[model samples]
Target: MRTIGVLGALLLFVEFVGAQTLDSAQVSAIDKNFWKTSLPRHELQWGVGCPLLEEFIIYGMGSDDLSGDFDRPHNWFDKEVYRGSRGTTLFNWSFSYLYRVCKFLWVGADVTYIGFYDVYYDKFTHQKAYINSDQLLTFMPKIRFSYLNRKYVTLYSGISCGIGWVIHSEKKEVNVVTNWAFQATAFGVKAGTSWFGFAEVGLGYKGFGVIGLGYHFNRQNRQLFKRNSL
Candidate 1:
């Protein structure tokens, strides 16, 4: 499957790319400073983006009720058919923690959830009914490459491999599908000292792009040195 290949490629890419960013001396210094001093150990992020759920749900429907005759209502008490389908990015969140392994390498794990509620109607009897919903939960152990780690700003590239489950309830039947999840690449930048804002774009289960705000609890300790001191 394409997803399987992507998962493998993402793992290899992170290792190869993270390795090429630094030498042994720089890595040693970074590791020494990390354990010898206080540094931020975790990151919590909240964001919103596209779920890309509409098409997938429609495909799963396997009928034209939701797509073709979505607006036309035939009868009630008949076989339950899709009244309509709507996709959204109203819920999305990610949490990750990184331990400095080298100047350019930070290893961590991240978990994320993206969900949306789809409203279904009963052709003629019901009006504006909200009974259908879909949710996706993913857990990824990732590796990040910090190209520039600074007090006020951070630039990084990351990759992750994980599994995701899609949960949906149709009529009275609940269907759950699990698949290989991969983040091909995520390039992002954070700006601020304590509370920061960040934006990133890449291909993944979450979406094609991500934007959010976060708070770094150990921000003060994350700064290895003052910029003015350099």
Candidate 2:
């Protein structure tokens, strides 16, 4: 009888352990499903870039005539001609917000600022003629598509169109300030877990080359497929 009782207790213990293991598996599956279906609705990012690189392109686009040496020198700054030379510096920064529409797409908006300063010299008068500083503020609505959305890195491209307002000192001015602006192409690579760093380039908004950081409101949203075993 003693032997039989010991065998029965052993059998019962084995059955209990199996049941517990089954319960744990079921719980894990449920958790996975819950996470897979839920995601964050919004994200925010900030970036900075050098806008001065595009100064020549921006100015050249506006003028119909460039008979002078301005086009020949291939120089971005310090162009000296019949008049005294002029020099410029620019900086770009932006804050953007995004709302996830689905797994791979997002629609959002951004506000970008391009700040520039110029020094002008008039050789005819042998004097510093003007010092001009201005800021261009642009508000744009953007759409983005993300690919290879993995935990470590993601690739993305986007486009934006909007209006820009030029804010300048009353004493100074710029030629061909295009109030209507459009960014037809923007592409970048991002890396991180939940908080990320990115390097991007685009044709508009500060012209090209952006580096920045972003954070996802939900940690689970970082994974491309959340339901998969982690």
Which candidate has the highest TM-score of all?
1
Worst 10 residues of 1 by lDDT: 49-58
RMSD score of candidate 2 (Å) = 19.6
Tens-place lDDT digits, model 1, residues 58-142: 2565643434545566743345545576665564566565665665677877677876667777566666655666677878888
Best by lDDT: 1
Q: Which runs in model 2 stand beyond 4 Å of their true positions?
A: 1-40, 52-54, 61-89, 122-127, 168-178, 219-230
Q: How do the predictions measure up, each by TM-score?
A: 0.68, 0.60
